[model samples]
Target: MKKIVIPFTIIALLAACAAQPTAESTESTEPTYEAHKQASWLLGRWENKSDQGNLSEVWEKKNDSIYIGASYFEIGGDTVFSESIELIEKEGVLNYVVTIADAGQGPTAFKLTKSSDSELVFENPKHDFPQKITYNHKGDSVIAVISGKQQGKPHQETFAMKKVN
Candidate 1:
């Protein structure tokens, strides 16, 4: 009777272990293509002319898993500020990467925290400034908002741009 009971207990433990979910089964199975599709609407050229300067952003789909973009601010036909951007999907996670031209620093990566058909939010809490970035797309316009702590104080900036092409 003791031997029979021990065998039954071992069998029960083995069954319980088999029933538990594995990490691979629990992780997201979403494909990179599907993730990129969610952001396909951002493709095209966007421009904003303000008293401050003329800002332009252009995006292009590089492949099924990547989108390339660039933004620049021009004053009197000279580019004053510019940055290169890459939206990539890897391992079912989306990342927004930006490199400021001539900043003498490597690119910064922001992970996608919220996403919808018309709005996307990326955040990097460890970043010094603009820890949160959001893009809201309307019919023919897009509004980009960046907010975070600047110099130990809260700060935010908004850019309203219209699709030009």
Candidate 2:
């Protein structure tokens, strides 16, 4: 009886080892998503500050593809400059078409590459503005640096922002 039990245990262990998956079989090509109920990425307020010490913007998105932003300046002790057109982000690019009553210098197209959670290469060719924005999550700060030339002249500006509730 003892001899039979030892042999049976060895056989069971060998069978279990054989049943394990190999490296190739364990790997899957399928994409997976986890539902994040605690992190409300789209339900917060965001803003940016200008290096000139007189300009800034406040932005928010409600529902799907409905983004609204406002520009605030300290021209004379805090003034509201203008609000931006509604926008949407898909894939890795942000697309915002021109809309009536926007505070831009003109009817501008807003496009930004959402590189990461805290970085974007924002451009408004219609307004002839181009810049890169970098953000720090812990500090809730976004730094904006303009690039390229405007109307045949170099365009440059730096801005920062803090996340608000």
Candidate 3:
């Protein structure tokens, strides 16, 4: 009886230990701040369909809750326009606020209308851009289609980007 009791206690202790998980083992499935920054397609350089040339944006972290990036457009070997994007998130929703620094336009704020693993859309009635920028994954490249308005007419620009360190 003593031998049986001792074995049963040992088995119960082992079972309890197996049922418990360590802190590292219970890690979150969601992306961290660094991962979120990396997951975004806006992190790298892009080109317009026209002669706007390569637009590179460097992302800077603002505290623990915000990210800021700037973009400049060039044409004919000269800088034509420049802009800044401020992105923030709370409760899984991303807010994109764009400022046309060089164009002298006020800031426009947009909300995340739709999103997926490969695509995200930011739309605001007051903003110019409506349709979401679709990022489709190719073999080794990402195709970004930015659809919006240019002089009250609908227009779309496709940009292909390769992730570089």
Candidate 4:
């Protein structure tokens, strides 16, 4: 009887150990937004100075799914252009929205068309000039490219910016 009881107790102990939960097993299975994770890398201040204008872009993460940024373009010490920007994850899709202070229209939104570890592209074919925009991050610098058809002709602008903060 003692031998049989010992064997049964050992079996019960093994079963209890098997039933215990593990750290990985208890982890949530909910899906995480990959775009938000990718966008987190853009948070910081970037600036560029050139003969045409001095441009600066500052980005900050507002929350888990939203990033806010602002861009300023100054020519000859005068503010030529400024815009408020937002990167939002809505319904699992990423949108880059720009609200130009002088555009005299509603915010323009560009949808994410392509993205990688160090690059992102947004496009809005229905918008006027600059229907496509791209940002390529390399080390401590970023190259911003905006291109599209303007006046029935192709036009593109590129800015090489370095991280300032």
Model 1 / residue 56 / CA error / Å: 0.3
**Predicted candidate 1, C-alpha RMSD:** 6.0
Error of 2 at 8 (Å): 70
- Score candidate 3 by TM-score against the native: 0.58
**lDDT score at residue 75, model 4, on the 0-100 scale:** 98
**Which 10 consecutive residues of model 4 have the lowest summed lDDT?**
29-38
Residue 61 displacement in candidate 1 (angstroms):
0.5
- Over the stretch 1-165, how does candidate 3's per-residue lDDT look in tens digits? 999999999999999999999898899865355424434655544444455476544556664447787767666667666788877776666777778775666887777676666665667665556445555654446675778786789988866756553
Candidate 1 wrongly placed segments (more than 4 Å)? 1-32
In model 2, what lDDT does residue 150 have?
A: 65
Q: What TM-scores do the predictions have?
A: 0.81, 0.51, 0.58, 0.79
- The sequence of per-residue lDDT tens digits that candidate 2 reaches over residues 32-98 is 2111111124235556445544665555655444556555566556564544544555543465544
Clashes of each: 0, 1, 0, 0
Which candidate order results from sorting by lDDT in descending order?
Answer: 1, 4, 3, 2
Q: What's the lDDT for all of these models?
A: 0.93, 0.52, 0.65, 0.92
Summarize candidate 4's per-residue lDDT along 92-119 as a digit string, tens digits. Answer: 8999999999889899999999999899
Scored by TM-score, the top model is 1
Per-candidate Cα RMSD to the true structure, in Å, reads 6.0, 11.6, 9.1, 7.8
Query: In angstroms, how far off is 56's CA in candidate 3?
Result: 2.4
